[model samples]
Target: METIIREDTPKTPYVKLDGEKGVVEIKGRSIPENSVEFYKPLIDWIDEYGDDPKDNTIINIQLEYFNTSSSKCILDIFKKLELLFKKGFKVQVNWYYEEDDEDMFEAGEDYQSIINLPFKMIEMEE
Candidate 1:
């Protein structure tokens, strides 16, 4: 599968999905004007990746901020990972947050509560 790579902009996050390495990362602020357009292809890519079934799939999400639409997209991504886990793939999520960002840390914790896959809330010095 081809990787998804998009540099971060003021309104969107950076997406780097390396199918070969089984590491997918989405970092930066995500408040895209067209959330559906920005996330559709990513959702498709994850669907394809889930089919082939990698041994380990690690998704790292470090978002400084996001809008409601983007939050929905993130939930969609988590659902995809849940599906992969159900199919017997080793899946993990590392949700990175800045040291002093309580809201971001809590958001990660909230996501962890909703999803069945293993999730790690990581604190990064910013």
Candidate 2:
């Protein structure tokens, strides 16, 4: 599958889902006006990538902030990854949060609990 890359906007995150590289990264803030529309293509890309995923897939997420709607959209992305993991793909997530950002840390924790894949909570130094 071809890679999916999207530039970050004022209300969205920068996304890089490279099937060849076996890496996925989402950084910056996520507060798109239309959460579903903003994330649909990304979610769809993952769905297609699931068919013949790499031996190991690493997802790195470093969101400065996000809104409630974005939270749900983020979950959708994770769920797709979870399915790939369940199918025996070696999938892991690295959730990065700035040090002292309790909210972001807890949000990562929440996602870790909700998703069944391995997750590494990374703290970025201030």
True-structure RMSD, every candidate: 0.9, 0.8
Best by TM-score: 2
TM-score of 1: 0.96
Instruction: For each candidate in the order shown, give its overall lDDT on alpha carbons.
Output: 0.91, 0.93
Cα displacement (angstroms), candidate 1, residue 74, comes to 0.5
Residue 76 local lDDT, model 1: 94
Location of the lowest summed lDDT over 10 successive residues in candidate 2: 1-10
List the candidate 1 regions with Cα displacement exceeding 4 Å.
none
Tell me the tens digit of each residue's lDDT in model 1 across 1-126.
788799999999999989999999999999988899999899989988988967999999989989988988999999998999998889999999999999999898888888898998999997
